[model samples]
Target: MRLITQSLLVLALGVGLARADGETAGEFDYYVLSLSWSPNWCIREGDARDADQCDARHDFGWILHGLWPQYDRGWPSFCPTRHRNPSRSDTRAMADIMGSSGLAWHQWQKHGRCSGLSSDAYFALSREAYATVTHPDAFRRLKQPIRLPASVVEEAFLAANPNLSAGQITITCKDGGIQEARICLTRSLEFRDCGADVQRDCNLNRATMDVIR
Candidate 1:
């Protein structure tokens, strides 16, 4: 699923045809690369897929969520044909960074398949998109819960990645805790402004970023 976008949960089931050739229904404007907070996901969905990542001893911060193709307002999904499944080695290589094998598979089936790239190429692009952003260290491993204005979190990220701006990212919060950081980028993998709908939902008031440990 392309989390933080219109097709957020479409990848949960990974519906569609799997074709040998890589063909998409259409092209997209840009991409929204989502980096979900591992600790937060473990806390909420520990019993779900990828329990190993939820272990208290694991020190994961923001793991690759999904690199979603996007339009200015909406996105395309369930395209005509799908790309083949990722190779065993590719899946293994991305497992640690992606959090789960199921996620990697589903992301390709649902979102990545529509990107007009082979499963291998689409995932490779996802990795590049993941590396395009520079996350703040404070959120990576907070020993204790920190309470700060959501703007501080956004500003921290902005400072870390000079190319990003206030409108280019969103600091998503759920149950009053920091959820994930959603960033907008061009098809060229360059930093860019997000559409209004993709902008951060952070508040000016104090918010909480619960430590992953």
Candidate 2:
């Protein structure tokens, strides 16, 4: 009888601990605006895929990766929403900043659904959030690949956006190269300090930053 009781208790606890595929929409603490360094991404993975964004014709620099709703600790994704999904034209319009319509659709399906908004509204908010931050011209002017401390990237961003502090942003690295710059914001889109988990910064002394195509 005691063993059966213990087993039942464990089962109950496991069920309670399990996370759902979809969280409730419109409930989150903050947002993370992720900007990918296009050239670095191209070198690492995009070029192999023959991604159009990597083409010299695009001349892409930092592109919008996603505008994600975040919790203070973890984040919500693929949440069920009452709003309708974006149409083909809607996603295509965002390609100018997002690099591809495919990314726009993916972002909407994953992160935007959790915003408690229609796809159009979510994309609009994403664009507005993106425009609020200035991409440092110094990076765009890079004539050749450079290896520099990852912290230099963060400092350049801070200089460009005076309202932003070190706590509000983080730089990430992958494949031995600079990857993305993620900035935290309030629900209202004002700059805010990131949660502890989101505040992890790449401490690379020399991370390669590829030149813009």
Model 2 residue 173 CA deviation (Å) reads 0.4
Q: Which stretches of candidate 1 lie over 4 Å from their true place?
A: 1-26, 47-50
Q: What is the lDDT of candidate 1?
A: 0.77
Per TM-score, the best of the predicted structures is 2
Q: Cα lDDT for residue 82, model 1?
A: 47
When superposed on Cα atoms, how far off is each prediction in RMSD? 9.3, 3.5
- Over 4 Å off, model 2: 1-19
User: What overall lDDT goes with each candidate model?
Assistant: 0.77, 0.95
Could you give candidate 1's per-residue lDDT for residues 85-117 as a string of tens digits?
A: 787777767877787777888787777867878
Backbone collision count in every prediction? Answer: 1, 0
